[model samples]
Target chain A: MSRKLSYREAMREAMHEALANDPRVFLMGEDVGRYGGTYAFSKGFLDEFGPERIRDTPLSELGFVGAAIGAALGGMRPIVEVMTVNFSLLALDQIVNTAAALRHMSGGQFSVPLVIRMATGAGRQLAAQHSHSLEGWYAHIPGIKVLAPATIEDARGMLAPALADPDPVVIFEHAGLFNIEGDLPDDWSADIRSARVRRQGKDVAIITHGGSLPKALAAAQTLAEQGIEAEVLDLRVLRPLDSESIAAAVAKCRRVVVVDEGWRSGSLAAEVMARIMESAFYELDAPVVRVCSEEVPIPYAKHLEDAALPQPEKIVAAVKEMMG
Target chain B: MTDHHAAAPPSGPVPWDKAFALRLLTDMLRIRRMEEKSAELYGAGKIRGFLHLYIGEEATAVGALHALAPDDNIVATYREHGHALVRGMEMGSIMAEMYGKHEGCARGHGGSMHLFDARTRLYGGNAIVGGGLPLAVGLALASKMQHEQRITACFFGDGAVAEGAFHESLNLAALWKLPVLFCCENNLYGMGTALERSESQTDLCAKAASYNMPALRADGMDIVAVHEASKQALRTLRESAGPVFVEYQTYRFRAHSMFDAELYRQKAEIEEWKTRGPIHTFTARLKAEGKLTEEEFLAIDAAANEEVAAAVAFAEAGTWEPVDDLLKDVMTPPPPAPRPGGGDAGSPPAAAPCEG
Candidate 1:
């Protein structure tokens, strides 16, 4: 039976389960072993899985990620945790050029069943270098599947399906959602396709994902208090977006607000808005609005940090404006 | 090192009867001819994109590929026309791929630098330096995990050795004891940057040895030597533990690609290497050994020319993929599902995050 757990605990449980079930599955990253995860997601895994499986690597992202890709190619299920999205830039080539493109390039003869998990999004006031969301960049690639596990259930269940998938899958764990706790159903399984409706409303639809899901939901609650019911959609799979669900929500609500943690320009939110315009424009009663993070480097100061990101107030304001 | 003698008696000198040798010669000649035609085609603006000719590199691919079994996997770089031809991919399909026809090996999706034939287990004609190494490692890993008696041979130029992927792949192959043959073709130049200028340690075997894997070097210009060395190395890899690295000291007589201006090295250096060209040197050796005659060489050459003519015709007649299916194969379409959230319009489910 599934029980209530925090996003951190759910992710830890998934890793623990994978290590216990598969002899080939292992964890490797900068602090995935003795130091637990950098976010303490795998706090007690080192003692459970031992150093061999729960390996701690040097501060060489390219070396270790390439090694992980190698290890995956070599018959092991390597879950490489690249401490933060900012640092994953060092290993970008291996992920983009090698891991993702190998399968189709091989004429479907080879598949890299590798899973890479990295912390993304900004809410902790960690300055410019640390606070960027680049999951959309990965989603732009063709061969790999990109997943953002926004909830506890997704954190617990996504790893299994990801490991089972025959292609490389990149999982982005929002830095802001680790402590958020929720009830897990007795039979819970999170599919890596389609969007999950977080809140039901008919007046306006609030579409978002990753770290922004919580803020969107909070704004939906605030909107509910003001008697403006907002439908909240959590986009779990970023690459092959569940456009049907999104289109359905837009058709019903007729007004939409996209809440994205990424910058406004060339954002995933932009893609969603474009899709809406292309498919559901005639059904829309008002123009779709977007509440994206300010088009600037996420600042370190508390006030500036709040100002840089999409907040519940911003979502509330966007939804109210859309309702009008 | 103790010589682990062959378990089987050399497959009777590798079945290199007159017919087989002629076939080998014909195969190498076909690659040479097709590439020559491709160069002409590139000049005429019929074949666009980077066209890396496998002119002088033919014998290395023909020799080394002949040593491998059909079940074994092959991963090669952009300059892989020879490897693709010798690995049993249909000549017509590869030619069609070069022409970017829909009937090509990769169905026109991948061009000259990305020829792929899954039926022959030719993984790719990868353009990215060192990109195919990790893929080869993974294929070998799958074979090992599945308890299949298969090896993956990855071919890249010396330039790929300088890539981090090369070192990482070497270490993983050694650590996991995967059956991989890392074939490095040291053609001396990574597109105008000579190996001496790019690499700090010129001895590539020394670098591979750092991973505790056995490494060998061969005269790539000599087809017999390459064949013998690769056969021995494959035997060692198959019978023993872990991966092996083979450095084939080769030279490319043609420009790096069709676009090269031929300004990188001196004309004298080119003439010097051409003296040891694989075809001329091997044909001379075979004639000296009385294994082949001048008339037999001509017969093989005529047969290769005939095959190339037929392949060109086949490519010319190939079809293009319909524009309607341009977005196919991006993702496997998902199965139909019942609409979630109580078939739509059910009160927005209380801002709940997805459950595990």
Candidate 2:
């Protein structure tokens, strides 16, 4: 049994389920209430959950995020929605310093069972200030879990396990995927741990996550038409980088291409390629290559923004180059 | 702005009965003695890192903490030895934490600036200037949502008033009508930057007033005034179910940290503030009111010394956490089986995502 839903609807369903099932759960963020969330993911949530549970916060990221951390400590499951990953920098101190370090700093005495959701990646012409893919920066932290839900099923299912986890979890919902519609299986629950192979092939492995997953999948389709078959490995969980799955994919395909929306230097693609070298160095037929965003502030013009991001054409070209 | 030089010595009666009064005094003395011992230990290389002494600010923590119920939560700043002590954290554990020992309150992970005790409902010994405010607001938010009858007390220095977190947290608490007692221990300097130099509006009460909350100022040097003001603030906070802000005007006698060279202020100013020293003035008032005898004062001082000595002994005996267990608490261990929708473990694979 399956249903069709957009990524926005899927995420809304996940949040609604969480709020309905847990009395301790609440959602607070800028425009989460009457404005219905910046992405319209929580449109009717305010009416359903009421004011106390569906809190509309002022543009105080540090305050609300820290308050969410405190609420989690006080035994409430709080999901804070920062409008975009670009603005999350305002609350970075609370998220990185306090929420991530609390349990360890408190000597295992406290764990922040908090989930922070933010829009990431760029497809629209939202300029430098609004468009950022800093999930890799968060993935670098030790005490928190970083997840990028790229598929409709993942958008619907990942929230449950993230809220259930005892530590802080950051879910980056690709801004481009919210409007994309897909089939949602009746069984939509997903693990917040492993990487899933989206498409199976033997010639080359295309490793990516979040907004780039669909591009990788589309590129694989394009590659298959030309005599080269590419495997699409969606890294659902970014932080504890499902190294096992990555290594398996690398070992199976021997040649690899990593796709990341972040800039080339110190990118998640960089980390994935390094992990492949560490775990499956001997299995490589060629050196791993990556298709990453150009090292410039994402531009406002449509063409420039597209140029700054990884596209299906770029992914296919990278795969073909690796296959050769 | 408060004129520290012109302020009169804290006088007048302590209304509480002998036992309660003595307990408050003992709490203050405990902080003073413990910190003094900690200073000596720091010199001996026993306690490393930044050692911020709460020597003169003891009255604020002791008096304000007494106004709170045992179940109420506490969030304090880096100069929080007094707050932690007054909130009932074990002196031994506090010293052990400063010593970086396994038996410390935070098991040596958090040092003096981050003494967290779950047993006492003390949220943290936060080092960031305005960091604790939002956490306190959240704690109150949780309590209000859960229908719990407890308020959270947050302590920060005057310097924190200038941070964005301070303004944002105050607005949030007031907007939500959360039950939190915003205790601002206005101890003249924030690491040698005087409050007047940092803040555009030095009147912290005005800052709170701008948030539309009832703001009060207390003589932080006077334990009685601090207690009375805090009691009034907490009372209003509980009755109204809204936040209240109290600015405890105080001073820090010691340098900002062990590394500071005491270059910012004049020695005459320190001497002037010393006359209004919380312990001496309060003891003098107790003598004038015939509430305390000289022998009783000596005994109390002796007892505090003994306690400090015992805490030092405990910290000395406390062991270092093994290097093998360094990565123990970075994350909570995952459950045996993955939690499904809404955290029900065995909810069947019906909700599991289908393989694409």
Candidate 3:
């Protein structure tokens, strides 16, 4: 049983289910209530769940994020929606320091069962301040689990396990995926771990996640038309990264090109490439390559922004280069 | 700029009954004695890491914590040995925590700046200047959402008021009307930086008032004043949907930490604040009122010293956590078996990490 849903609707359904199912679950963030959500993923949620669950918080990221951590510790499951990855920097101290460190620092007596969701990536032309992708920066931290839901199934699936796990989880929703429509399976068995092969082939593996997923798929299609088979791998879980899947992809297709919307210098693509070398070096036919955002602040102009990000043509070029 | 001086003599008689007055005096003595011993231990190299002594700020923790119910949550700053002790963490755990022993409340991992105990509902001795405020706000939000009648007490220094977290938390707690008692221990300086040097708005109560919360100022060197102020504030919080602010105007009698050079202030400055030391002034007040005799005072002093000594021995006898288990608490122990009402949802259904 499958039903068509926009990625945004799938996410909203997941949140609605989480709220209706758990008495302790509530949503709080800026404009989540009245303004429907910065992305409209939470439109009509307040009317459905009322003000108690769909809380509108003051513009205080550190305050609310930390408070969410506390609420988690105090026996409420809080889903904190930081408006964007740009604004999440203000709450990074709380997210990285307090929420992540509390369980370990408290010697296992406390765990922050908090889920923080924020829009990430640069396709929105929102410029450097609002459109940067920093999920890799969050993925760098050890205390919390990071998930980038690239597909409608992932958008439908990741939240339940994230909430069920007794630790802090950050879900990064790419600003580009909200309107994309796809079918969601009734039985969503997606866990908050492992990568999935969106398109299987034998010639090369294209590794990517979040907003880069569609571009990688497009690149794979172009490669297919040119008779160069490509396997597209979507890294759904960023932290506690499913290196095994990366190895499996490598074992199947010896060469890999990681496409990421973040910058080339110290990006999640770099981590993936490093892991591929570490785990599947012997299997590689050529050195692993990457197509990442240019190493500069994302510019405001459309052509420059597209050039700065990982695009379908760039992915095709990178993989074609890797395949040779 | 005004020169530093001790707070004036506390006015009026001991408002509390004799027994209660003696208990307050006893708690201040306990903190003062424990801190003195901790300083001595640091000299002996028994306790390492940042040791922030709450020596002169005893009245703030003892008085404010005494006003809260046992089940309430307490979030304290790094300089919170007094807060933990007054909140009923065994003195032994506190000492062992300072010594970095496994038997310590946080299993020795927290050191001096991160003492945490689940049983006492002590959230932490949060080291960041204004870090604990948001957590306190959340805990208060939890209580409010759950319809629990408990309040959350958050303690921080004057330096924290300058932090964005302090302002943000104040606004959130006030805007949401969460029941959080924000206790600002204005001990003149944050580490070496004096309050006046850092904050343009020196009046902390006015800052809290800007958040639309009622703010009260107390002489932190006077335990009775602190207790009275906290009680009044908490009463308002319980009656109204409030997040109250209490500024305990006090001073630290020692260097900010063991490593501090004390370069920011003069010796005369510390000497001036010591005259109004919580222990001595309270002792004098109790003595003048005949509520505490010199012999009885000596008994309390003797008891505190004995307790701190035993704590040091317990810490000395404590053992190290085997290095093999370093990653034990990094993630939670997996959740328990599901109830019949729930679906089995956790545990990533792929190859788990660290397993071959």
Candidate 4:
């Protein structure tokens, strides 16, 4: 029995459930214990799970993240939350070299089974250092699963399967979706391998994930007002991207517009476009156009931040462009 | 402190017998010969890419590895030809890996710096400084959690001590009382930078002690001393108290890599260290004790040369992986399910009972 909850509440519930159910599962990150997480995601978890499980780590991304990987390899289910994707750069070596490569490098003898969660995307006037979506970079690596839990159901469900997976899984929780509320049905079980179609349509397919999903859906609404029905596909699993579902959507819609919060050059949207070209090129009515963040560091000012990110209006424009 | 050189030798010639000593010497010599050949191969452009040789540090790996059981896991740095050789990985496969051939232990994916053998429980040839330390800690953690009687021996250079992974691994190992042997080869130089210039506290043992773990130092050039220290450390670690740190004061007889100009240290310095090389010093000690003669030493050298020659031939005959199957081993292939009636059923009958 699930109720409508915000993305932040959904994630907090997932952590709370994991801690309550699994004795070995623990949460460690900056401000996750006492300060209730940087975005107030784990507000009262310290009191509930105690300091041991809901740990507050020092501002050592490389140190703590590497320790989390070690702890995972040590037979503990550790969920390490890096405050932002920008800060995750400090721990990239551990993530890419150790967690992602260990299973394959060890000749399938070991698996890390770690879950690294971080808030990505830029739109809150957080400036350059605090903002940036690098999920595309993580998605490029093999032997690791990449997930973008954009919906409330996914925010609630992704953690369990991620913990169950043998290999390492990196979950990108966009900062913008934290406060957005959505319905969580009673039988909401999220699959880590398929893309969920948030809205059904026939004119065009709006392929997006993470923070861009809401914008894509909103743009679809705007597109519906203009008599062009757009289907919104939220790519939950980003790494072994559900290409079959994407191909099916492309084959049905005949036109596609990808909206991603990452930069335009070499983004996950580019990978999706390439997949469409490889699998469903003949079914396309027009060339796939992408509405990605401008190739620049996210700005601090509200207007520039909005301009630098993929906004609903921009996604609508891209859909209209694809339609013509 | 009284000099222990004249002290009574342990009852009946210590723990190592003649066969074990000979095997240790053979292992060191094998690494020495293989590395020498690899250097020659590098010069001739047969083996490309970065090659960090473990020439003078052979005793540190050979002696320390001999102290560990076959079930124990080993994680080593990029300069791990010695570790891989002593860890019981096939010499031909390791050489083939360095040659980037499909017959390599890692199937040609990881070359000189990344040789891995799962059968021997050798974790990696990790190139990142202090990278293997945490992995060793984790392996030990797994053993501790699973109640397995195994210790993980991690080898890294003095340069890796400066990395955060080193500190974090030490703290975690101590905090958890994990059975990990942190073997730091204090070669005194990190690529071009020396230990004195890089570290504020040059005493590596003191740093390990700060984490509340047992720490010791040994003359890495002396193979017997390295063996005794490592054996004691491994014994303590296997008992599951906590991690132990052994700082082997060693030196590199050659350039850091083939491309290194070696402007960081002096030529005469290398010549001075070469005087106390592990191979010669240990051979001299064995001869003095009547355990080895000049002819026996020549035989060991000849055996190492033959082994290396055979490895080179194997690598030369090794093939390259086909480009079409580049994506293999990225993930483990799902195992084939068992048939319903216990017979081999191709692709499993559609209505058959699901057997994992």
Candidate 5:
């Protein structure tokens, strides 16, 4: 049996289940408790779980995030919520220098079993400070796992396994997809390792993840109408990218268009393109193209923001150009 | 501040019993001997990278470590040879680590700046100025939540006082009332920058007190003072299950690192501070109190020198970790292969390098 659920509801249900199942699991971040989460994901959680579990922290990103790492070291599973990717920069030292490096530095004596979830990507005219996808920057690190849950099933199911993993895992929840609805099957489960084929086709592979997944799917629909079949691949895991799945898609389609919400230069799209060149260069039917955000701070103006982001029309245009 | 002299020569009677007092003196002697040999090895090119010696700060580490239980957590700075030694990390492992050998504490991965020992619950030799504070706070948070009778003692230099991490970590620990003992080793200088030059408020305990935690100060060059202050702080932390901060007023007797030119401070100031060297002053006091004799002091010094020589031999015999295992321990290894019959299915492949 399957039921319709929004991404926000599914994620909420997932967190509720995690908290209920494990006494060691607790959520701590700015506005996570009494304020019901900055995005309202934890609405009414404080009432049910009380102050001890659903902790509301001050705007001390470096302090709280580092503390979460310490707690994880002290034998507790901790999930930290950074309100947005932009603010996570304040805590980057803990994430990169400490959490990521601890296991290797300690000669395999310690592993930080921590999950950090943050809102990423641009869409709601939140302006420069609130928008911008830096998941790629995090993906560039060596010791952590990066996940972008694009669908309801993933938003609901990724948290459990992420908590189960022994190393630090970072999940990017696209701010734009919270209200989007989809039918989540009762057996929905997710693995935090590989890319998933959202829509399979043969003409072109539209490779993307996070907020760009829906845009690539929409472009695939438009391409289907034009008698061209496009394969949509969601790069669910970014750090340890699923090169096998990416190569499989490229081998099948022979042409690729990478859609990323981050800027074009040194972007996730660039990484995906590099991987295609490295792994499946012989399978290329055409030069791999990318549809990424314009190289500018995401602005508040709606039209300008739309122009800067990777939209359905942009993905469609890139794929069409490749097909031609 | 430069205005302050060598702290009136740490005047006090030796209060501990003869055996306990001698043990403290012996630990201090061990650190001094080991680090002096480390300096020679660095000059000889056996120990490479930045070697930050904890020469003058021995009293702080020896005193504070003896005050805490073996199970309590310790997070320390890059100049952590003394802390690791007092915390029970073998002297040979510390020397081997500095040699970048696999037998070292961190398997040659973490050199002088990142010594970590799980057996002693010593979290790290965190190189960043204020990096270890948050980890200490977090460990304290875990202890409190799990109702464990353990506290986390985090040590950083006076330079870390200027870092935002210092302010933020203190606030978080105090706000949650976590069992953390923030040990600020005020060695008067952070790298080359003097404390007054770096901070507007020169009093470190004032800053910690501003975060609503009780803060204390001790004569860092005097092991008895540091040990007594630490004991008092730990007692309060355990009783209240809250954070406490202690400022150990001390000085570094050597250059910040092997590469340091030390152009910032004057020769007279270093010489003046050396008069109150923790080892000699404590030995003199013990002699005056009839707890230690000249023969006993010479014997202890000789023993420490012997241990350092043996440690160097151990380091010279240590092997290098192969480049083939470079990526090992970067992430946890995958779970043991699934049961034979049923066969584990749907397990994500272990994270391997993209280049491979």
Candidate 6:
């Protein structure tokens, strides 16, 4: 039997593998060292990698991320971790302005080979401040590549390629999916580009990424029994949008439903739908629908939070509505 | 401490030899002439965007940069035309960048505010208030991890002391014992806001020392002081495990930019600072010591003018980048495609562009 690993363990394994393989690759972030990471991702890494390799940073996201970019320029492959996507706003200027613009601004003289990993999405009753689906905002940027690793394979495989990439790459690890365990084949490597068809169907396409991917899968299963075959397309790479795969899914299914944790207003789902409209409009059987979190700030209560997020039932409803 | 501003006129015999003295003098002159022409170009609409001139602040860059090796990394602020020139960046590329030309450094994508060159290790001409501090920390971290003896010199205005990045970077660098030279160019103002008005505690050295860092203050107007202070910091960085902070007490002669109407300060104050102008006083001391004659000074000035003219002509001839190639280099040429059907699904291609 293939060994099963949780999404969090897959990420930790990938980081550990990168560190053990490449001397240049070091992990730096708040609480990543002695504290064992805010989410316990870097547990026992400090002793293995030592204090130098496993750096614990102060609550200075802007400083550390910028330093990570500089280190990348100075010829070290750095993997920077921000506690969550909500706190990443503090370092957005460095990510967008410095990391993204450095290579082109330097006229190809420099490339920031830096990887930034941050937990994202709303679940576990973390409330508004701790949880936010800001991956959509990051995906809007052009210079940096954005990744949403939903599956255990993706969580395990994406880090190596991201660290291997010359340009700055931001990986969004949905907080909700961290504990979800799945089977991982021995060879668990993947590319940082293109969407993957987790479940193939011709009747409808359930397009989504990150925390919403599981919900999308469950919804697909529900739609399968109802005689509506829905293809579950995981948008692995969000920035470039894996337009080819998105178009392929839309063309095959002819009906589309975008499930995202972000709100409907100008979300990544909106951008995906717009691309589908532009490229696969003629093939569409019905208007593309979106099942997104409510526009209000996510409340702490479980029922309110669940009601606000994209549930499996919600994805099923959106897919059914799109098919109709 | 009365602002020494070229105190006591060089004592007796000249300190630096003729060749070395002339090189330092010529560097300041080059910055002065380039920026003077840049101001004219700005008026002619040849160079747009914010042009922060380093007219009087030449000594700080000229002296400090000369103290470091060619391979050392430099992270500077927007008013960095002088730093770029002193670090051996071509004047033509700097001028061409201001012109937004394809042949320019950074290929004209970043205007006056953003100047970068990978070959020279000039990290950037960072414009954000305290943006370069964190970058310098990172560069030093890389050098430390690789066991390389290179130092990362970060230059920023006193305005940066107010930023959280400055505090965090200082703490990080100090705690980690990374090799970094924190060059604080205390030019008295942060785009119209004076130091005392903005900062609660204006003593920069004390702030750096609070982080358990060894700090010093240098006369930013005096080339010798700036150079010596930088060398001291460099030695500390090379020998010691921690970072050093040096506050360059300097002033700017021109308005912050072409847009300023000189609203904040008085003309007399500007004139008083001009009395302490780095170029003329250093030239005066050189003349008194006979290391520089009137003819030699004029010749140096004339040479600077000629270089500025040549740079302007070069910028005039530079071309614009085609809009089609705009997307190139955003990512590292997307690594060459994985070969046929042989490689493992999880394995990366051999042509990985990172860690080079």
Q: Pick the candidate with the highest lDDT.
A: 5
lDDT of 3 by residue, B105-218 (tens): 888778889989888899998988899999999999889988998899999999898899998999999988999999999988888888788988898888898888888788
State the fnat of model 5: 0.53
- Tens digit per residue, CA lDDT, model 3, A96-124: 88988887787777888889999998887
Worst 10 residues of 1 chain A by lDDT: A102-111
Kindly report which residue stretches of model 2 are placed more than 4 angstroms away from their true locations once superposed. B1-11, B339-356
TM-score of 1: 0.87
Error of 4 at A302 (Å): 3.5
TM-score of chain B of each: 0.89, 0.93, 0.92, 0.90, 0.92, 0.93
Name model 4 segments beyond 4 Å from true: A12-28, A31-56, A71-77, A103-110, A277-282, A321-324, B1-17, B43-46, B147-149, B175-177, B210-213, B232-240, B334-356
Model 2, DockQ value? 0.50
When candidate 1 is compared with the true two-chain complex, its DockQ is: 0.24
Per-residue CA lDDT of candidate 4, range B1-356, in tens?
11112212122342467778888889999999999999999988889899999999898998888888898878888898889888888899999988988888877777898888767877788888988887787667656656878888889999999998899788878876888899999999999999999999998988998888888778888788789888777766656478988888899998899999998898999999999899887777777777888888899999999999999999999999887757766754544443332112121112211111
Estimate candidate 5's RMSD in Å. 3.9
Model 5's CAPRI class is acceptable
| A187-216 per-residue lDDT for model 6 (tens digits) | 555887779999999998889999999999
lDDT of 2 at A224: 93
Q: lDDT, candidate 4, residue A147?
A: 97
Model 1 stretches with alpha carbons more than 4 Å out = A15-80, A98-114, A164-166, A187-189, A301-303, A320-324, B1-24, B235-240, B335-356
lDDT of 4 by residue, A143-251 (tens): 8899999999889888877766666889999998899998898777765778999999999999999999988988999999999999999999999999998998999
Q: Which model, 1 or 6, shows the larger TM-score?
A: 6
Runs of candidate 3 exceeding 4 Å displacement: B1-10, B335-356
lDDT of 1 by residue, B36-92 (tens): 988887887768989998788777898889899998888899999899988888889
